[model samples]
Target: MSIKITKMIAKTHCYIGQNHPNYVIIHETDNWAKGANSRAHATAMKNGNLDGTVHYYVDSQECYQTLEHQDGAWAVGDGKGKYGITNKNSINIEICVNPESNYYVAVDRAAQLAAMLLNQYGWDTSHLKRHYDASRKHCPRRILDEGLWDNFVKCTKSYMKKGTNAGSVKPVKEEEPAKLYRVRKTWADSKSQIGAYAYLDNAKIACPAGYSVYDWTGKNVYTNTTAKTGTQATKLKGLTPADLIKKIGPLFTADQLKTGVLASVSMAQFILESGWGKSGLTQKANNAFGMKQNLSGNTWPGSKWDGKSVVSMRTGEQKKNGEHYTITANFRRYPCIEDSIGDHSAYLAGAKNGNALRYAGLKGCKDYKKAATIIKNGGYATDINYVNQLCRIIEQYKLTDYDVKAGNTGTDSKPAATTPTSTTTQKKTFKVKVTANDLRIRKGPGTDYAFTGKYTGKGRFTIVEEKGGWGRLKSGAGWICLTVNCVTRV
Candidate 1:
C-alpha cells in the first residue's frame, strides 16, 4: 500500500510549462524492451530531447514522478477536447508493461497511484480516462483486450474508500431460488434451448418447436412431441459441429445484447464443452458447458441457483504438469438448455473473484478472440489450447455473424483498413512499431484483399517488403498498415 514514489522531474523543455490538472489519464508503455520499468522511463524523462512524455511512470515495485503534477506531458495531445481532457488538464500515468515486469502488479500500482491522484485532486472515477479514450489509439491494450478498465475503476474506488490498500475487495452476495426448469429441443443439444423458467409448467408452456422439458438435473420429465418440427439446414461435410448454431443463434445474440458477452465465443464454448451437444453429460444432464457448481456457486442474482440440483459425473481434468485425471464431480444441471445458456451468460457477467468479475469485461466484449482469451485467462478451462480451440470454432463457423450488429462490432468485422493515397516503397527489411490493437493482416497488400484472420499486436515486427504504404510481415502472416497511425518505422 505504501508505494514508493521516486521523483525524477523532467527538464522544462521536455514537457509543457504549466498544467492545472482536472483529471488523470491512464496509459501503458508498449515497450517490451528489457529493463523498461518505471525508473527507466523516469530516467528518459529526466534527460532532454524526448519525443513524448507522461507525468508518472508506474511499475510493480514503485511509481516514478517524471514531471511535476502542474506541468503538461506530451501524451494525449491527439486526444484533446474529447472529454475536455487535453494535455494541459490531465496528468498522465504510464504503466510499464515491459516483458521483465509484473503486469498485474503494475496495474495495481497504477490504480493505487490513480487513487492517490484522485485524493490529491478530490476527484472521482469520472476523472479517469484511458489514453484510447482521447486518441482512439489502443494505449492500454491489455486493459481493453481483457476488459479490465471497469475493474480498474472499481479497484481505484475501493482504494479511495479503504484509505489504505491493505486488503482486496469482494463482491457483495445475493439471494437465489430453489429450482429451475429448462426448455429445449433435446436434452443432448443444449444450444437448442430457448428458455429457462422458475416453474415447470411455465417452462413447458414456453418450449418452442421442441416438446421437451427437463429438470435441473437434466432428467426429461415431460415430452408432448416425439419429432423435431423445425427445419434443419444441410451440414458442411455432414458434421454436427456447430450445426445447431443456427438453431441457437438467437439465444447467444440475446445474451450478447443484454450482457455484453460475445455470442460467437460463447457459442464456441457450446461446441467444445458440450461436444456439439452430443456429450454424455449434455444428453443426460443438459449441461452443455460442463457447468460445475463451483465453490463460489452462482454469484449472479439471476443465476443464484438454490444449489440443490446437480448431476454427478466423471470428468477429465488436467494439471499444470501435463497430468490428466478423471473424477466424479457435481455439475450444475439445467432443466433445459436455455437455462444452461442463460446461466452461463449470467455467470460471466456477474461471477467474481474477490472484487473482480470472473470474466471481467466479457459481458460486452466485441472481439471473439479477446473474449476467448479472457475466458482462458480467467481459468475457465484447463485445456492449454482453450483459446485457440474457441477461436477456431468461432472463425470456422462464422459465429460472429450472430453477434449484435453495432456497425463493425465483432473482431471479424474489423473497421475498414484505409489505404494511404501516398505510397512508400522500401526494399530492405526493417522493423515497424505496431500501435493498432486490431491491425488486420490482409492476404494481399490492400484493404480490398481478404483478411488473413491474423492481426498485428502492439509491438515491433519485421517488414520484408512494402507497397502502397503497407508492409508485408516477414513471417508470412500478411500485409499490414505501414503508413497509417498503427505502424511506424522503429
Candidate 2:
C-alpha cells in the first residue's frame, strides 16, 4: 500500500542528509485497534497536534509513511544534538501493535525493517533505540515486556553485519518446544541468580534443578502448559547470558561493573529495586536508585521500585506544635541508570547516611555492611531497619566485591582534615590597572569567576593567596580571587 504523506510532512525540512551519521529509532503507535492507522494519518497534521512524523510504520504486513525518507522527524531529543546529529539525523520507525493483540506480527516486521535501516545506513545495531530512550514515555511496551526485544536486536544486528545465515532464520522451532524453569532459592545459587535465570535457555536444555517447567512468561503469562509455550528458550541455539552481558554490562562503567554497583548503591540494590535494571525506572528513567527529592515542583520524572512496595511517609500530621512524618506513596526517578547511580553516589557524598560507611576510607570501617550499619544508626533513614535491609542485600549478593575493586576504592574514605594555613608570612603585593572594559574577579584563587559588586578593583585588599596569575583578596564575602593586576597589598 502506498503510504500517505501529510501536508506538514511536505513542508518539513530535511534536517539530516546522507552526510549525517544515520540512526534508526523504534517506536510504537501506542494506540490499539484496526483503524489506528487511519487515525494516525488524520491526526498527524492536525493544527493542535504537534507536526511530528516518523519515517516508516510497520503493522503486520504493510508499511505506512507519514513523511518521506528525506524529511526530518522530531522523534528523539537527548543524545541527538550532542552526537552532532539533529532531529533530522534520526528516522522514526514505528510499529503498529495493539496492546491487546495475542500475536506480535508488527514486532517481527519492525525487527526486519530495523535491520534494513542499519544495513542501508552502514550503522551498527547500537544505533537502534526505543522511543523511550529520548523521552519519558512508553511507546513499545508490549514487545519490550515479551523479552523478544533482545533477540530481535541480536538477530537484526547479525543480519545487517553479514547477511543472515540460511539456517539461522528458519521458522522458530515448534515441535520440541523449550520449557521455562524457575530457580529454587538456595544460598549457593543466590549470588548470580538473576544471571542464571536470564541465561537458562542457553545452558543446554538441562534443567537448573528445582526450576520446574515454565513457558516464556512462565507461570505469570500462562495458566498451564497445555497452552502454547511462550518464547521457548530451548528453541533458539547460541543463546547465552554472555550475549546479554555483552549488550548490557559494557554500557556500564568500570566502577559499576567491579563494585556490583549498578548505577549507584550496590548492584544488589538495583537487582532488588529495579529487577536487575528491567524495571521501567531503570529502562526508561535511567534511575536505578530510587532516591526521592522534590525539585522545584517536579518529582524525579521516571519509574520507581524498592524490591517490594517502598514504605514512604504517606501523610504529615500537623500536631498542635509540630509535624510528624507519616507514611506515603512516593519514589524517586533518574534520567538514566547512569544518572541514578551518579545521584546515588552524590547522595552518599552529600547526605549523612549509612552509605557513607561504604566509603573505603571511612575511618575504622572496612566494608559496606559495616558502613551501612554506621550510617543507619547515625540516622540515615528514619526506618528502624533500613540499614539492616541494605546490609542484607550487600551480604546476600556479595556486592562489596564490586566496590572493593573500584579504582576509587580508597577515595571514599574520609581524608584527614588539613590544618588551616597561617597567613603570618607574606609578600608585598602590587596592584595593576584593569585594561579590559568588562573584567571579572573570580571566586577562587584564580581568574575563573565573574566578579560581583564585592570586588571593584578600586578597593585595596590584602593578597591572601596567589597562583597562576591570580590573587586572593579578603572581601566582605570571605576570600575571593582577583587577577594579578586588579589589586595589591603593601
Candidate 3:
C-alpha cells in the first residue's frame, strides 16, 4: 500500500513539540462502522472533528499520513505515562478496523508502514509498542482480544528482514536533551547549591537539608523527604492534588493582596496549565500558572527576576484556525511558588497589547466569571473552553473566598494598589532591544553608582523608570545605560 500524504492543512490537536520517532505505537481505530477507512479518518482530523489525532491511518487499500511524525499525537496519554513511553518521544500509527474492511490485511499494511518508520530510526520490532503498552487501555483491541499482536510483530520483522522499504522515509535527528538537572536552593541564590546530577533519582539522593533538586529550568523537583515535613519539604512527585493546593494557594493569596488580580482565576490557571502542579514545567521551572517564557523577552514590572532566570522549553501555540504548533521560548524561573504568582500577577496587571493592557480588567474583578471571560478575550489563552474550564475550577475549589474587595468590579477600574487619588505625571516607558549581552547594570542612574553585578541579556526589555542616562529594568533587577551603543529604543 502506497502512502498518500494528506498533511493537516492547519495545525491540529497533534502538537506535543518535536521528538525523535524512536518507537512506533500500534493502535486499532475502535470505530466498527462500515465506511470508516484511512482517508475518512484523515479527512475527519483535517476537518477538526476527530476525538484525538494520530500520525498515520493505515487500511488494507491505502495508508494516509494524517499528522507529521516530528510532532506528537494526542493518542496515548491515558496511563499518565508511567511506563516510560510518552507522547513526546514516539510515533503513533492507527490501523483501521471498520467492520466491512479486511482487518487482517489492514494489520499487514500497518506492519509495512511500521517497517518504514523502523528503518528511519535503525530500529527493529522490539521498539514497536502498542497503545496498551503506553496507557494500558484496550487499544488495538481486536489484536489484543484475538491474539493477533504476535503475528503483527512477526510480520513487521519479516518486512524488516527483506529490507523492502529502507529508503522510503527520511532519517530523523534526535532533539538535544535539556541542559542538566542542576540542584540548587533557588535559581537566584545559587551559593547554597551542593551538587548536580544527570539523573533525577541521583539528584534526589544528593539533595540535602534546606535544599532541593532543580531541573535545567530551575523548578524545585525533589527535596529531602526524610529530613523535613509538610508541603515545602515533601517529595514533589508524591504530593496529591490537595497537597499541591496547600503549596500554591497561600502564594496566590499573598500576590492578590499586593496586586488585586483574582486569586481564584490565577489559581484556576495554575491548576489547568500545570496539571495541578505535576507537569514537568512546574517540576522544572516552578511556574505552575503556565507562565510561558514568551517569544518577546518580557520581564513584567514587579517581577523579581532578571532575563537570565528562564527555562528554555517547548510550549504549544495555535493559529486562528485552532491548529497548534510548538515553539521554544523562555519561561521565567521562580525561586518559589510565591515568585511565580507575583510574576504572573505583574504580567496580567501590566502587559500591554499596544496602549491597552492585555488583561486590563482582571485586576480587582470581584466576579470570577467576568475575570475568566476577560482572560479569554485578552488572547491570554487559545483554548475554546478556557473560560468554562477556569470557571469550573474556581467553583469546584471554593476559590472565590480568596477574592478581596481591593477595587476592580469588572469595569475599567484600577486595583486598590494602583488607584491614584491624585494625578502625577507618568514617566514615558519604552522598549530597548539590547544588542550587547554585557551591558552593566548599576545601583543608581549615573555611572558613579555601584554595580549590581547583573547584565542585560540580548533581547528587547521594557524600560519603565529612567534617570539621566540610565533606564531601570521593568523586572526590578537594576538599571542599564539608556544611551549605550547596544541599547536601541524600539
Among these predicted structures, which one has the highest lDDT? 1
Ranking by lDDT: 1, 3, 2
Best by TM-score: 1
Candidate 3, residues 1-490, lDDT tens digits: the string is: 2233445432577674565666799999877677898878988988889867888887756677777677887888776779878777788998898765556556766877887788778997889998877876656765654434654676676666655452244221124333345556787776555444434654554454567788867887777654432233124444444445555666676677788888878888877676555445665556666676562234457875455666544444556664444344457666666667777888888887877788887887878899889988888876555677678667655665555555544342322332211112225798987755456677865444656656786789998875433578888888876543345567
- For residues 1-490, write the lDDT of model 1, one tens digit per residue: 3345767888654345678898899998877778988888788767764678888898766677888877888888886677577888889999898776657657866877788788777888899888876676666766654345655777677667655432342211223222346667678887556444434554555453345888868888777663532222111113323336556666677667656778788878876666456455665556778778784443565773456766555555657753444344577756667677777888877888887778887776788888888888888877566677677557656777777767644444431233222224556799987644566688966544655646786789999996644678999888885533334566
Look at candidate 3 and tell me the lDDT of residue 348.
85
Off by over 4 Å in 2: 1-21, 32-34, 37-50, 77-80, 83-85, 100-103, 132-149, 161-490
Q: After superposition, how far is residue 70 of candidate 3 from its true place, in Å?
A: 24
* Candidate 1 vs candidate 3, lDDT winner: 1
How does residue 357 of candidate 3 score in lDDT? 80
Model 1: lDDT to the true structure: 0.67
lDDT of 2 at 389: 53
Give each model's whole-structure lDDT: 0.67, 0.42, 0.66
Candidate 1 stretches greater than 4 Å from native: 12-17, 164-437, 440-490
TM-score quality measure for candidate 2: 0.36
Question: Relative to the unseen true structure, what is the C-alpha lDDT of residue 133 in candidate 1, on a scale of 0 to 100?
Answer: 67
The candidate, 1 or 2, that scores higher on lDDT is 1
